[model samples]
Structure formats: structure tokens, C-alpha cells
Target: MSLNANDRSIAAFTMAGHALVHWFETSIPIFLVVWLAEFDVGVALFGVVVALGYAPFGLGALPGGILADRYGTRPLVLACLGGMSLAFLVLAAASSIYAIAAGLILWGIAASVYHPAGLALISTGVEDRGTVFAWHGIAGNAGIALGPFVAATLLIFLEWSVVAAVLAVPGVLAVLYGLGAEFDPTAAVADDADAGPDEALSPAALFSDSRTLFASAFAVVFVLVTFEGLYYRGTLTYLPEILHGLPAIESLALPAGLEGIQPADYIYVGLLVVGMAGQYAGGKLTNRIAPARGLAAIFAVLAVLALAFVPVTASGVGLAPIVALCGLLGFFLFAIQPFYQNAVAVFTPPDARGLSYGYTYLAEFGFGSASIALGGFVLGEFSQTVFFAMIAAFAGIGGLFAGALLVGGDRFAGTAETLEANADD
Candidate 1:
């Protein structure tokens, strides 16, 4: 279906917003090594600080969703961009470790609003949501990849503080664009209008009537998302450090004037860049495949790849093979996102989509934050082998949940179809 000019405009703006938010969020990890050296903190302690910064990204999502539903997505998105810009400004001026921690916490809080608000706008406002979501995912992956690449490149020449300030420019531009943009929050579904006025906005109503949401299909998806969060945050949080330890990457030849750049930084960015294709593929898969089955397949690959990472790197294999494995890992890891995101929409009522995504990210980011500390401890106390094993276990559990969904999702399929039919009418 062809989108009208307004729909295209909204999609473009929302996609840009996605990139801006993720750019800020993902840049933090790239800055971690710099912070570690400057602060002289141990890995475990730094992990805790980073966890504090990341925790709010999950913790604040539910409220962000509620606010989006109550106030409007455009304003919340604008607030997210503005608040993130302010947070980066704070980071640029930070002097002490506490100051840095505070800036990161503020950044986390500001970043938390984007996923629900942005996704809600696309889910409700766009006509061909799956394709739009694909483009959105690609934009997010661009941020994910570029955040580190840009930060790493800047760090080679500029101070980290200056880099922080520079990173806020996109948010500023996005805020300006957001202020003048027009979007319809009620364009996709009329579930809210169909409900009793009292029930439409009542949190009590949301909970009391959430049994359908917590039934077999949604419950399985939640479990799957929780595990995905654990694996995602656990692995990606320290990936640069992990790659840095590899001798193969360390010995690679470098170009002129780029001697200061770490191989790990390049590899980390490369992995995320490769993930952009995975995001697009997963998005396309949503139209051609069942969400549950697609989730099961990709997650199963994630489990195997997680287990293989340490072994492959440890085998003293050359840089070429190791880099290929990293690329594959990136592809499977990010490929799971679009599937589960689509699954959430399929299993929930339209009026409650914001809440659905709120809880979805809460699992993916909130519980996922625990992995930072857990992974830090394992890395500090035990070994990388143990850490990768734990990540693999998380993927394994997530695959089980996806498999269960594949077996049982048929019971809930009608919920999405009925909602879609209602919207079409």
C-alpha cells in the first residue's frame, strides 16, 4: 500500500528520532574504555556505574508509555530528544565520577521514552507497519553502529567531553523537526473509542482486563523477551573489552594516522553495521513468516553462536574467520528484535499497545540491565568462558520460549486479525 504524503512524513521523522535516540544510547559503551582510563576504576565498579545508567532505560518505559497514551506521542518524543540533548550537555561538563554517573542516569531516563512513543506512532499512524518498522529498525541499527564508530573516530582527535557535546547535535535537530511535525495518534485503530470512557484511561481497567495479555502467547513472548534482554545487554555491554582481549584482532595491520584506534572498536562497530541487514531481513520475515517461528529460528541461531564465540576466538584462528563469526553473531542477535516486536502487536489489544511495549521494553531493558553486573562479576572473578556460557544459557531459554509460542500461538492469532479487521473497517 502507498502511504500518503503525511504518513511518509511521519515515518521519516519517527525513523530519524529512532536513530537519534539509539545513537546516544549506544555511544555510551564506546565511551566506556575512555571513561575507564580517565577514572581509573576497576571493570566491576565501572560496570555498576554503567548499569545505573542503563537501568532507567528499562525502568522508565512503562511510565513513558502511559504518558504517551495520555498526552500524545509527538510531545513525548520531543521531550525525549530535548531531554537527551540536555543530558549530553551535562555529560560534556562532568568532572567527577559521580558527575558522569549522574549524566548517564539522566541520559538513561531521557532515552527511555523513545521506544514506546516511536513504536506507538508507527504502529498506530503508519499504514504498512511491517515495512515501516523495518526501516525504523534499520535506522536504529544505523545509530547502534554509527554511535560507536563516530565516538571512536572522534576520540582519536578530540576530547571525550567535546565528543559528548557534538553527539547532541542530532537530538537538537530532531527536536526542531518534531515541533512542527503533524501526526494522528488515532489513525490505526479505534480500540479506545470502542471502550467505555471510564475504562479507556483507567489503569485499573488495564490491569483487571489484562488476563488475555498474560495468557499463553503473550506470557511466552514476555519470557522470550526477558531472555533476549539478558543475552543482549550481557554480551553487548562489554563486547569491546571482549574483542580487545583477542590476539587475532590485536595483531591486524592498520592504515596511516589510524594507529591509535583499537581493533576492538572497529570490530564492535563492524558487527553492528552488519546487524543492519539482519534488522531489515527480520522485518521482511514478519510478512512472509509467523512471528513465533521466525523468533524460534533466529534465537536458536543466537544460542549456538553465543556458545561458539569464545571457542572460535580462543582457537587461535586468524582474524578473517573470527571477524566472520562476529558478523554472524551480530546478524542473529539483532534479527530477533523485529520478530518479537511484531509478536507483541499481534497478541495485544490496540488500546493497550503502549502498555504492551512498555512491559516489553521493561523486560528487554530492565531485567536485561541485571546482566551488566552479573557479566561483570563473572568476567572479573571467573573467566570469559563462563560469561559466554551464561549468555548462551539465556539464549537457550529464550529459544525454548519461542518454540512454545510457535506451538501455541494459534490460539491467540485471532486477536490480531480481529483488531486488524476492526481497523480496516
Candidate 2:
């Protein structure tokens, strides 16, 4: 796990970028509560508004991957940081729901490129890939936790608009750092005959590369991540809002200045803070175990947690048990990330690494984000039990796909690059 200079440099830059991405992403859920009150809209309508932003976050991953492959990770990474900062500034000036959606859409488009670019850079550049992935997840989890904490705290003093404008500062600083940061993006892959991304960006080449990718085990990983996305977005998007309604959270009180903060917001932040551990554990676990098995096991745990959510939250037993459940939920929710990310690397080639990650996230964020709308509708129309049940189903289905990979053994578990090397021999 000891990283040399290049690995450290890549890790530092990617970790900063990783944190910023989630900083913006996780903060939105906190904003959801505010948006609900300020916009005076029903949950279903507002959900669509959020989806307008999030859908593009997922939908744009493919082109982001293509651009990463064609142009290199640095430029896209820089653009992602710069664009996201500007998008939030746009949010600061928004006067209506439409303007908010426009700002979010811009943010999504800008932020969407980071994962494909950052992960691909690590997969190809960093020497200690799993270690870096662990650190990367930790950084993102930091943002996940801190973003809400900051937003919740700021909402105590400033308007949501000013808070968003304030949030833009870190990303702007990150961009300036990224501009001068140096590392060979292809360093680890340089020794391999097939390491570089494909040069051609033609439509036929794009189609062919995608076809070659889906013809392998990566296709299953894609489906698994989509379900991951569904469960993830569906559960987390309204979590603070959901928790705020809980008797456990509602009963709590804070001191004078902090009194404006919802007790549930703290719980939400606690859950995400615990995820940093889950992410690190998952990342380390990827090096020790089969990622497919890990994915299956983690998602199964998520299913059980999802099923337990309503029962636990509504039990009226007290804050301790609910807080514990949130802890477990936060942990396992993020633990699946590194497993699936490693699975992508195992199932695809270095040359197509960017596109593989692109498709992977497209399934995860793009298709998964639809659950935001679905969850909104479900929450609007049905009971909490039903919404959680839907989340359980997403987790169960994802677990099943991972189980298929486990059952397939080497036929599906073998790395694509290894098979290609063997075929060459």
C-alpha cells in the first residue's frame, strides 16, 4: 500500500476532487428540506426538479468517459471542478424553482465527469490502486459527511443561497491546485502493450468499443451498480427529511445558536461520517476477497437494513436504537462502492477503462437516479414501509446479480485483461 511520489500525487489530486464531487452531491439532500419549504411544492414535483439535475449527473458519464479517453483525465477533471463551482454560484442567484433546477442541471453536467476521469486515472496511473481507492472513498465520505454538516450549520445563520455560494469556495481552490498538479495519468499502464485509451472518437469506434465492453462481465457490473444507484439515491435523497419526522429526532433539542439545526441533520451527518470507515473497509476488502462476493454480501446486508428501517425508526423505542441503525445503514451503504469499482477494473481492459467506468456510472447514477422520482412518488402516495420495501428490492436485485457472478466462478470472475493476455500468448 506504500505509494511512491506519482501515486501520492495522483491520490492527493483525485482525493480532493473526490471530496468536492460528493461535497456538492450530499449537500443537495440537505437542501431538499429547504427547497420543500421555500418552493412550496409537493414532494413529487420537487423530486422531479432534483432528478432534472441528478439524471444528467449519471447520463453524462458516457461522454465524460469518452472525453477522458480522448483528451486525458486532467482536462476533464479541471473542467469538472470549475464547472461545479460555477453551478453552485448560479444556485446562489436563483429566484425560482426553475432557476434552481437550471443551476442543479449545470452542476450535474459539470460534476458528472469526475468519477470516470478520477477513477480511470487511479486505475491506470496509481501503483497501489486499492489503497488509493480506499483513500479516495474516505475523501468522498468526508465530503458526504461534512457537506451536510456545513450546510446544516450554515442554514442556521445564512440563507440557503448564501450557504451554496459559500460552498463553492473549496471547489474553486481545488481547481487552482489541479491546474498545477503533475502526474503521469498512464504511468501504471505504460508498460502494457494495450494501456492507452483509444485515439479515435468516431461513432463507429464508440459503438464498437461499447459493444466489446458489454460482451464481457462488465455488463453485469453495470446492472449491479444501477441497482446500487437506485438504493443509494432513493434512500439518501430524503433521509434528513425522513429522519426529521421521526419521534426520536424530533424530541431532541440543541443549544441557543445551534437550535435552528434539525436534530435529524446530525444523525444524517453521523451516518455519513461512519461511511468513511465502511468505505475504507470495503476498499481494503477488495484486495483480500472476490469483489463479486463482497458485492453480493454487502447488498444482502443492505436489503436487511432497508427492511429494518421503518420498523426501527417507527418503534418509538428511543434515539439510541435509531442512531445505531443509521450507523449500520451508513456503513454498509457505502461499503459496496470499492467492491464494484474493483469489479469494473477486473472485468474490463485498460484501453477502455474510461468508457467502462463511464457505463458503470451511467448505470449507477443515471438509471439509478430515476429512483429519486420513483421514491418521491412512492413517499408521496404510499407509506414509509412501501418506500423502504422498494429500496430493499433494489438491493436484493443487485445482490442477485453479484451472486450470479459468484456462481459463474472463473468464467465470469476472470479479469478481461488477463484473458486477453492469455489469448495473446
Candidate 3:
């Protein structure tokens, strides 16, 4: 289908919004080491403080979805941008740990609104949703890649406070851009005329029939997302620190005034940069492949990669091999996003896309936040080997659920086709 100028504009704006949301959220990890040193807190305690931000980021999604449904997505998107910008400004001004926690809490609440509002806008507002979602995923991955690079680079020249304030600028600009943009909430549903009756129900009615939703394929998707979230939050929370300890990275030659920056920082950024391709590829696959099958394949690879990471790190392998491993790991880790996102759209009614995404993120991010502390505790008390093994297990479990989903989906499709055939008689 041909996209009009308005459609193109909305997609661009939405993608930009996606990038900013991720940039703000992921940048915090890059600062985690700094905070730990500055505050003299234990890793586990710091993890909890960070979770204060992330937990809200996930928990707030449901209400954010509900609000987006009641109010227009445009306003909620604007609020998210504006509020996040202000939250960073708060972070920049923070004088103590309490102030920092306060800033993170505000940031989390602000960030929470984005996924529900943004995904709902795309899933419901755009006609070329598969393509749009792909582009949106790319934008998010770009933010994930750049957040640390930008934050790390800025820290070289400025205080973390100034760096945070600088980061807030994009959100301010997005807020301004959104104010002038035009969008049609009904455009998304209109594009899919055959949407089921359940798709058209309000949130309350949808909840009333929650049993039907859970009984269907969506429940399996939910389980897969939860495990995926745990893996994501667990591994990524301390990746930079993990990389920092690698002896190979410490020996790399560096330029003057850049000596303080670890090689792992550069590698971390590069790995995420590679994830953009994975996001694009995954998006394209969603158009051709069944979501559950795609998820199972990707998660299986992720499971293997997660298990291999510790071995590669401990092998005394050169920097190149480790970097290559990280690159592959990054690709599979992010590639799963678009597939599962598409899965949610496939399994749920179009009208409830917001709610579906809301719950999806709640599983991915809200419950996912627990891993931050868990990882910290694991690392502090045990070892990296155990941590990697745990992450591998999470991915493996997710893959199993995805496989089950594939089987269940096939059975359901067969049953539906048979019922339709009988009705025609």
C-alpha cells in the first residue's frame, strides 16, 4: 500500500520518539558505574536504586495505555517527551542519592508512557504496520546503541549532570515536533477492516473477557516475553562493568586524553550498532514468517550465545574474537523484538493493540526489572560464569515457550479452518 505524506510524517515522528525513549532509558546503565563509585553503594543496592526508575518504566505502562486510549496518543506522546526531558533536568540537578532516586523515578514514570502510546499509535494509526514497526524497532536499537556512546563521549568532556541535561534536548525538540503533527487514531483500525469484534471492545470489556485472551495464543506469547525481559535486563545492566574487567581490552592502544575510556565501552556501543541490522531483518521476517516460529528460532540462538559468552570471555581470546561474539549476541538479542512485537499484533484484536503492547512491555520491563538486582547480587556474591548460565537458562526457557506457541498456534489454525468449512455446509 502507498503511504501518503501524512503517513510518512507520522512514521518519522514516531520513530524519532522511539529513539529518544530508548536513549533516555538505556543511558542510565552507562552511568551505573559512575553512580556506584560516587555514592559508595554496593552493587545490589545500586541495582535497586536503578530499578526504581526501570520498575516505574514498566509498571506505568498499563495506566499509560489506558490513558492513551482515553486521551489521544498525540498528547500522551508529547507528555512523555516533555516529562522525560524534565526528569533529566532533575537528574542533572540532583545533589544526593535521594535526589538521584527521585530523578530516576520521575524519569521512569515519564518513560513508561512511550511504549504504550508509541506502539499503539503505529499499530493502530499506520497502514503499513509491519514496515513501520520495523523502522520503529531500528530507531529504538539506534537509541540503544547511541545512548551509551553519547553518554560516555560526553562524560569525557563534561560532568554527568551536564551530559544528562544535554540528553534532554532531543526530548524537548520531539515535544515541539509532536505539537504540530497531525494524526488519526481511527486510521489504524480502518486499515484493517476485517478486525475481529473483540478488537473493537473498550478496555473494561476486554478485561471482562480476559479469560478468552489468556486461553488463546496470547498467554504463551506473554510467557516468552517475560523470560526475554529477564535476560535482557540481567545481562545488559552490568555489561560495561563486565567488559571493563577484561584484560584484553585494557591493553588496547588509545589516543591522548582518551586513555581513561575502556575498550569495552567502544565494543558495547559497536555491538548495539550491529543490532540495528538485526531489527531491520527481524521486521522483514515478520512479513514472511509466522511470529512464533521466528521467535523460537531467534531465542534458541540467543540461548546458545548467552551460554557461549562466558566461555569466550574466559578463553584468553584476543579482543577481536570477543568483539565478534558480542556482535552476534547483540544481533540475536535485539532481533527477537520485532518478531514478538508482530506476534502481539497478530494474536490480539487491533483495537486492543495498546493494551496488548502495554502488557507486553509490563512483562518485558516491569517484571524484567527484577533481574537488575538479581544480576547484581549474582555478580557480587558468585561469579560471571553463573550469571551467564542464568541468562542462558532464561533464553532457553523462552525458546521452549515459543516452540509451544508455534505448536498451539498451528493447532488453533487447523481448528478454525475446520469450523469455517463446517459453517459453509
Residue pairs in steric clash, candidate 2? none
lDDT digits (tens) for residues 1-425 of candidate 3: 56666567778888988999899988898788788877767898877888789778899987777667556577788899999999999989987888889989999999898887888787677777767777888899888878877998798899888998999999999888888887675576775542222223455454543445566677788889999999988877788798888888877899999877667877887878888888888887888899999999998899889878787767677888789889998888888898888888777665455667778888899888678888989999998999998899999999999999988775444322332232233
- TM-score-based ranking, best first? 2, 1, 3
lDDT assessment of candidate 2? 0.86
* Native-to-model Cα distance after best TM-score fit, residue 421 in candidate 1, in Å: 18
Q: List model 2 lDDT by residue over 1-425, tens digit each.
A: 57899999999999999999989987897898998998877998988888788778888998999888888888889999999999999999988998999999999999999999999999999877878888899999998778877998899999999999999999999999999988988898887766665565577667767775676687788888999999998898877778888887787876879877767867887888899999899988988989889999999999999998879756786888888989999999988899999988777777778888899889888888788889989999998889999999999999999998777745754455543443344
Model 2, C-alpha of 145: deviation from truth (Å): 2.3
| Segments of candidate 2 deviating more than 4 angstroms | 28-50, 92-102, 155-164, 253-259, 412-425
Span of 10 residues, lowest total lDDT, candidate 2: 416-425
Global CA lDDT computed for model 3: 0.80
Per-candidate alpha-carbon RMSD to the true structure: 3.8, 3.4, 4.6
* TM-score of each candidate structure, all chains considered together: 0.88, 0.88, 0.86
Local distance difference test, per candidate?
Answer: 0.81, 0.86, 0.80
